[model samples]
Target: MRNNWLIAACCIALPMATGAIAAYVTIQNVQFWYPVLRKPIFTPPNAVFAPVWTILYVLMGISLYLVLREPPSPKRRLALVLFGIQLFFNFWWSILFFRFHSIGIALLDIILLWLFIILMIRQFYRLSNKAANLQWPYLAWVSFASVLNFSIWYLN
Candidate 1:
């Protein structure tokens, strides 16, 4: 049983670590493009993003674990798969926009990522309502990010 707890901690840690790495990737590159184009007048200060993501990634880890604790079934696996898809898209957006500096591709990636979150929410709702509920903020954030991505691509 102690081994199980150890595994659980590692499982939760994986996404959190990935998220921190992703955030660093963002912070280190944010300035790279700041001077290149006109940012939206409403663009929030860079400082806001870190606190927000820290909360979201913790929520994500909890949601993933909640979904995983149930017995094996198609529903459980589907929920996990959808969740994974959204996560991949999340990391990819950072790579596309920050690393490659392709605003158009980043916009495209965000749109798809938004759709993946919606699908994950629906799948998670079927398995555990709380897990589904936990993701709403993440979804909302992604939706907002999608709009921000579009604006960035369009204005620049």
Candidate 2:
């Protein structure tokens, strides 16, 4: 029981900390650079992004925790690998879009991130249905973000 909670905390901490680091890299860009961009008509207010992303990252952490608790197996291993890859791209997107201001490359990165999220969801489902379900919001958010990314790229 103790180990379970500990593992869960660790899993959650990993993603949340990673997200904070990514946010740190983009903090100045979001405050200064992003405001000047040619955004789409449907763009949410600047205040909307932080809370939404925090929730999504928490969901991702829980999903990963569920998967990690599964017994060691090939399926579990693959799921973890896919999760790591998706997480990497998730982190990278912030740097690419916000910090570097590479909207075109960020669009491409988000598409890849979207696909990888789907793949990760599928793999997680094979092991834990709850784990896979947790990723739906993350997937949906990213899908919307993809369009926003493309629109930003097109406008800019």
Candidate 3:
């Protein structure tokens, strides 16, 4: 009983800390981010991004719980590590593109991040079908973001 709550507590912590780190990265570069050459039409409203990201973060937390619930194995451990790397790249891209305004490096970072995510999805799927299923939405979002990033890089 106690262990379940402990696991849940850890699950909650991961995304929250990631989000907090992402927020700090944003706060340090708001003005710069606002001026970036974002693509038209599909670009979401400022208000929309916050809510959407919030939902995704919650989903991420639950997905982590799913992965953690499974039996231990080297494969699961590797998947988790890959997931962490993708997340690190994910968190850093915002800072690079927005805070530093390095479009070229950001583009490269996003590409690598996308690859890592796809790999993570594959590994996660192996651990638990549901765990892999949960990452599909995240994969879709990143697919869209990659196009967006390419468009911005091209535009600039």
Candidate 4:
């Protein structure tokens, strides 16, 4: 039981830690550089992003924990690989958009991120429905974000 709890904690921490690192990169530009961009009118207030992402990361972590708890197999390995790839894209989006101020590149990164998310969801579903369901909100948010990213690129 303790081992399970420990594993769960580690699972939850992984994405949360990734978010923290991405947030560090984002903070570098969010105040000064980001304000100058011609964001889409539909863009949420800056205040909305933190909380939404926080929730999404937690959900992602829980989903990960669920998957990790499943028996080890080729499917499990593939799911883990998919999760890692999507996460890498997710982290880099912040760096591309905020740190480097490359909106066009970030848009491309986000489109890839969105696709990887769908693939991850499909793989997760094969293992656990609850795990896959948890990813829906993340996907939804990223979908909205993809449009927002494209709009920002187009406007600027």
Can you tell me which runs of candidate 2 are displaced by over 4 Å? none
Local distance difference test, each candidate = 0.83, 0.94, 0.78, 0.95
Instruction: TM-score winner between 2 and 3, please give it.
Output: 2
Segments in model 3 whose C-alpha atoms lie over 4 Å from true places: 36-38
Q: lDDT (0-100) at residue 9 of candidate 3?
A: 76
User: Which tens-of-lDDT digit does each residue in 6-41 have in candidate 4?
Assistant: 998899899999989999977969999999888878
Best by lDDT: 4
Tens digit of per-residue lDDT, candidate 1, span 30-145: 77765566678767787887788888888888888778887799999998888888889888888788877888998998889889999998998888998899999998888887
Encode model 3's per-residue lDDT on 107-129: one tens digit a residue: 89989988998998899888888
Candidate 1 vs candidate 3, TM-score winner:
1
Model 1 regions lying over 4 Å from their true place: 1-8
Residue-level lDDT tens digits of model 2 in 1-156: 999899888888888988999999899999999989999999999898889988988889899999988999999999999999999999999999999999999999999999999999999999999999999999999999999999999999
Q: How accurate is candidate 1 locally (lDDT)?
A: 0.83
The C-alpha stretches of model 4 lying farther than 4 A from their native spots are none
For residue 57, what is the lDDT in candidate 3? 66
